[model samples]
Target: DVKVTQSSRYLVKRTGEKVFLECVQDMDHENMFWYRQDPGLGLRLIYFSYDVKMKEKGDIPEGYSVSREKKERFSLILESASTNQTSMYLCASSLVSFVMNTEAFFGQGTRLTVV
Candidate 1:
């Protein structure tokens, strides 16, 4: 089964603090993505890495960054967490061949509350 694991199910951060959320997949998928889901706005991609050490900016890359040093791991970094940044962060992974229209398996999601 394709599995994606996220570091936290919930996180609380003070405003302006740096936060890191880790994701690991055991399926050796080539496409990894970081996205934040907010009410009304839907899922907005933060970043995505197609391969190890390669990254691409998504729809909402501001205040967020990502790293993919290994094939199985992807990390999302919030440079400065703010109250406005409070949202549900979701990590997903899929085979490179299924980049379009294929369902990306997701983590349980990390609900971040920045105060």
Candidate 2:
């Protein structure tokens, strides 16, 4: 089975702190994504990388950034965290299969709180 592992399950940080959230997948999938989940806004994509050393910004890319130096790992970085950025962050990976549609497998998520 494919597994997405997040570095931290919960995090508390002071305002203006820099944060790094790590994610790794063992399935050798081609795509990886980062999303922030808020109550009303639902899951909003922050960034995604389709291959090593390549990435595309998703809808909400203002305060978030991503790195994909390797095929199995993707990292999300908050460059100067803020109070409004407090939310649940999820990491997911998937493969596009021509024979059968594949679904993205999500991590348990890392809930981040900025004070």
Candidate 3:
């Protein structure tokens, strides 16, 4: 089975602090993604990487950046934490494909709280 691991299950940060969230997948998948889930707003993608050293901005990339220097690891960096940025962050991995049939396997999510 494919597994994705997030660095933290929960995190507390102060406003304006820089935060780093890490994710690793064991399946050697080609696609990795980071998303933030808010109430009612659903999951909003923050970043994604399809290959090493390659990254792409997703739906909500402001104040955030990503790194993918290895095939199995992806990192999400919050330049400056804010109260509004407090949400459940999810890391996912999937096999690269042109069809959307492949489901994204997710980690247990990191619940971040900014005060």
Task: List model 2 lDDT by residue over 1-115, tens digit each.
Answer: 9999999999999999999999999999999999999999899999999899899999999988889999999999999999999999999999955245789999999999999
Model 2 weakest lDDT span, ten residues long: 94-103
* Residue 103 error, candidate 2, Å: 0.7
TM-score of each: 0.94, 0.95, 0.95
Q: What is the lDDT of residue 32 in candidate 1?
A: 96
Predictions in order: lDDT: 0.93, 0.94, 0.94
Model 3 misplaced regions, further than 4 Å: 98-101
Q: After superposition, how far is residue 10 of candidate 3 from its true place, in Å?
A: 0.5
Tens-place lDDT per residue, model 3, 1-115, is: 9999999999999999999999999998999999999999999999999999999999999999999989999999999999999999999999896396888999999999999
Error of 2 at 78 (Å): 0.4
Query: Roughly what TM-score does model 3 have, to 2 decimal places?
Result: 0.95
| Predicted structure 1: lDDT | 0.93
